[model samples]
Target: MIDWARLQGVYGPAHDVPTLLQAAGNGAKEAWDELWIQLWHQGNTCDAGIAALPALASLAQHTNRAVRFPAIELAGEIVGAGLREGRPLEKMKELHQPVAMLSALADGWLSERPAGYRVCFRAKLALDGFPVLSDVLDDFLDFCCDVSCPQCSDKVSIVIGDFGCYSSIRDWNLGDVHPIPLRPAAPDDLQDAAQGLHHAAIRDEQPRLAWGLRHVFGDAECGTCDTAFSVLSALEAKRSPSTEFQENAGAATAPAGHDEGKNRHWPAPPF
Candidate 1:
């Protein structure tokens, strides 16, 4: 049993955490917002966040996906933060079952075809213990990521959306006029987390995401130096990329978009 008064949250003593959780479970968005601020602030988590795992799982179990989402997502964030902060292995071990349960809940939510696929993907990554990769999923959702050119050190954005998949300098007025089209990797060539993400996008019928995955895992060149680089590598250099997440994530099943006894192809981009 967790002693709320003894556990510290971002604000101070966590006595109000239970009340917040109850309100969140009762469909109060304000409570969930407050919980996010108190339990997870700018990627930092607290003892109260860790202590709330079991209760968060219960809250998810009893609510609709909208209400349930914040519960499971918060649990993921807490677990991910714990992993990233190098918390004691035994303490993490104690959380194993709850994390696994939240993971299952995330998968169930995904199967239900929620409004946001990226959020589901993020939750899955966090629950899978890949904190860095989970956070990077936000980049995919935004359809662009700012990265520095490996050769010239010029800042550029990799746009992967209806506008098209390419790299270009940040131009507010002109807007991507000097675009360097990205060369997307074929499904057969994809590996690691990229492969798994592509597979999930295909399976879930999110063609825009699938199309974006190709470019995300594909090749690019600097608009400044005209030097070539991998899009994935540039993104990784922006933060501490999780190598373990890469090596293990590739065990994903082969592309399932193939029609029986017929040819299959990458989904057409939404653009």
Candidate 2:
């Protein structure tokens, strides 16, 4: 069984949440292994499940971003898997309090250091998955709306679009806080595109020309011209099956001749 006494002992009055989270991140596998061992021996019970909540939540706010990111991710995984097993929803509800607390911490991190894109991104991701934390949602959306940098704004737009579409179930109000229009592409657009192509080429080992086409035209073959030709050229000599490529294959793809004016207040596209 989990050594409740040991966990409580480690959580003695002197050790703060941040410290414990750091420890958990540095030794997550070990810590989680212990937790699982305890859970397996103790049997699945409400109290036992609830007791693990605090430690897991603490890890979500670890000082090390690497540790904190995975901890938050793991919490989501555990809750999702546990819920599927017919576990009591109330036990999962108990986890919300801590998750919300971590969300607030993430908000603080973003506010204090706006350049920490990774932190802001992960925070948005966490809040998107945990709708019960309405307060965190409010703060995060507000931050996205107010942040002036295009990169930051893009991230915000992406998060707002994603949450608005998937998590909030078409509830645009969830994205009401920031109402900034997307900035027009500047001369830097080509540079940014080239850079994106370079990164993709490096990561996927595709030809520069093919990568460019895939980045630009995607699956929409220009009716007048072979858009696929351009994409294939960017790929250089590399050849891959196009079986998975479909016209407008992913939600990220813009609809052909899409009318933006149709919606009175269209939420911006998630980047």
Candidate 3:
């Protein structure tokens, strides 16, 4: 329902509005990717994305949380980005409409709508990690503990400044953390660790994720790691801090380490 003509991006106009709507309705990943790239060019302006807001907003109807959360998140990111870019003629123009549109949608969805669109809207924005991520600190930490994207460091091109996942890990650990040089120790490996921690002894005491992270280092908790399997339980379960950082990223500042600064040692904070 958005007047696509009102918005403009680096490209002329959003020509694929109808196609994108149909594609997203069908849960097309291509549509999602294209929309993200166009609207939030790696966390920037959203000429096309701004225009596509109405169609994207309608996605609250999506039954799939995985798909719906990410899509709605894209809308949140646009607003967050605009907020950060406050002032400056060009940035303001780029953000104004999308931010306003988001508000309008929230009002409409909250009052006359079903139990869907407005459900996770604000929460999703919070989790996006726009300003900071201390709330979902547990989730972000868990994700860092689990996954290792080596490819994240491969951005050697001039235009492509690849200082994202890997950089965040570095800052969080204060350059002391790096994935425990495990040859095959990726996210799945940590999942195995998580599985081991799921014994009857600690089963009732910790979140399911905390139980799995008990032995994240190897056969046991890494002694150097300040993040005890027990500590993670202080927060909610299944939180992936690293992934949260990736999901709702705008700030370069790292969140408070789940280890509470006791574990200044490398990758140990995530353990």
- TM-scores of the candidates in the order shown: 0.65, 0.31, 0.38
Cα displacement (angstroms), candidate 1, residue 140, comes to 7.3
Give candidate 3 regions above 4 Å deviation: 10-12, 87-123, 126-271
Model 1 segments more than 4 A misplaced: 1-4, 16-34, 41-44, 58-67, 77-91, 116-118, 128-142, 170-178, 189-194, 225-227, 239-271
Q: Note the Cα lDDT for every prediction shown.
A: 0.71, 0.35, 0.40
Tell me the tens digit of each residue's lDDT in model 3 across 1-271: 4566666754557666667667866788888777776676654655565455555656744676445555556766655454344423234464445445444444333333335432333423332222122232232233332222222322110000111122223333443233222111233454432333233113333343332233322321222332213223312233443344445333333333423354532334222
Query: Tens digits of per-residue lDDT for model 1 on 1-271?
Result: 7789899998788899999998998899999999998898767788898888888888878757658888878888877776667665335666768777887788777777778767777777677655665765533333666678988899877766544467777566555546777898999998765566667778877776677668877889888889889887787666543443344232222122323223423233554
Best candidate, lDDT: 1
Candidate 2 backbone collisions, by pair:
209-234, 209-235, 210-234, 210-235
Q: Return the candidate ranking by TM-score, descending.
A: 1, 3, 2
lDDT of candidate 2 over 177-238, digit per residue (tens)? 33322222222343443343334334433343222222332211222221222221222212
* Candidate 3 lDDT score relative to the true structure: 0.40
Ten-residue segment with the worst summed lDDT in candidate 3? 155-164
Candidate 1 residue 229 Cα shift, in angstroms, is 3.7
Report the lDDT of model 3 for residue 80. Answer: 48
